[model samples]
Target: MTHNSIRVHYGKRVVAALFGLAVAWGTPVALAEPVDAANQYLGVWNYDQPDRADATDIATVGQFGINPLTFPQVGTIEFTRGRDGEIIGHTDQGCTWHFRVNGDALDLTSTDQYCFNNVIGSGYNTYSWHVTVRDGREQEVVRANSYLGYGTFDFELTNGKRTRADAAGPGDAARLFTGTWMFDPTNPAYLNNLTSPGYQPKTGAVRIDSNGTGLIARTDDGCTWTLDARGNTAELAPAGQTCARSDGTVTMAFWSMSSDGTHVYTVLNSTDPQLGSYFIGSGSLTRQP
Candidate 1:
């Protein structure tokens, strides 16, 4: 198989492992007050890594075929101030932890465990997080020990208080996405497997018209686009039209952009497993001048 195909297969396995780990971590901790000495860790803080992509170590594989390095950028983690003044953290990835903070040192242990049979084989796993926050930044160490193997990941964080503008609903699409956008070949979000045959272009440009229509090169000529004003999310799909792919005809294949209007977050797979092997690709696209 090709290099991209290998990555795609591994990527699927990694995603499965992430969900398994999240399920194993159990539910969020209930609100409680922390000791007088540990109240400083309260409130939501954002993970910040100036060199996140570069910091990720893809060489080592953890349990369930996951790489711990990418965890920081994948989801949000928020710490809320409990009524009693305790530090409680909730992660968008479905895990929660209770904090025991002492000055700059902190300890966090998972409240649950999960087992699964994955690419890394069948096994059970547990997690623990240790962190230190100071001087407008935090350093965190996550340890994942499983029956298969043990892995550690480090992350940094800074305050991420939302401003009045950020909390506001989506702005006009013409202002947010109607422009020239180019896909970044080096930072692909997802790629097609080799079994899926297609001309997967890594470098190309696309234009979103002012009236919610998209014109992309080397793919479907055009498609109807919709943007949710409430959430800055956008979707591009042929809708009623059928688009041709290398393996088969696709009518529902679409690309979904997250709240970030600048990047394409996901691309629906075009391949029909029962029909045969054919996969589509997805990746981030940056606006061009």
Candidate 2:
């Protein structure tokens, strides 16, 4: 036996021992086995929320609430491994922290999705969302459930409102559009959630002014957008404002004057956010003195 050969043989034994020990640890070996399930649905968990939900919605029942929220209908969360080899999860609703997997618990450190990660963490500082690891088939189910993102449900509408209105108004078609145009409150907003029809318009106003040979418009929502006028009609495109849908589908709007230049008709047509269907929302803007 030579000294160099002995050293080489000792190193090989150390590597084999480490590998065997890792196999005995269980879950890590299970997670690293397929490599496919971990690859798919590994990032960006898109979970949209209304005011109500599974157990999480129990607290906000009577205090007045809203469904299909005004903005950001979808919440995004992602989990990734850090430089220290610890797993971290972050949510778009402003929460981030490291998570650890122990025996039967996945302990998340700081961030909580159900209202626990607050300055007080009072109404929600706790509670339940657990799964069963029944029988000898538990590991198989765990491996398969992560990939079970399939099927659909019947959409029902208990209450819905969308405003729709067609009324008279006044506006000038010349001088590249100048003056204040107020969106009528009676203008109907429409919603068809595959179950019911609704009408409840969003009240807003825009001020249009002439600058050089071009037209410019600003909304009360603090969005400055460019107006390209091609006669009595113009395309209102926001430069870099998220004034519309979260998906940027309704980024621009089209405005046209009634043939007599009495009312400005504004509309936006795009794919529905919730369901991939056609969506068209319109507003009747009357010139305000």
Candidate with the greatest lDDT versus the true structure:
1
Clashing pairs in 1: 33-84, 33-86, 34-86, 196-278, 196-279
| lDDT tens digits, residue span 111-195, model 2 | 3323422211122322222211222111100000011113211112222111111111113334425778776655222221111
lDDT of 1 by residue, 1-289 (tens): 9999999999999878877776889754345866565544554443332223554211222445554323223223566655544466675334556665645666653434443522123343335556666664555655444453344323222222221122333444345556667766643233411212444454556666554343332333343333222233344434324545455554433344432555543333333423432323334567766
Q: What is the C-alpha lDDT of each candidate?
A: 0.44, 0.37
For model 2 the local lDDT of residue 245 reads 44
* Sequence-dependent TM-score of model 2: 0.30
- Against the true structure, what is every candidate's RMSD? 20.8, 19.1
- Residue 45: error of model 1 in Å? 2.9
Candidate 2 overall lDDT versus native: 0.37
Count the clashes in each prediction: 5, 12
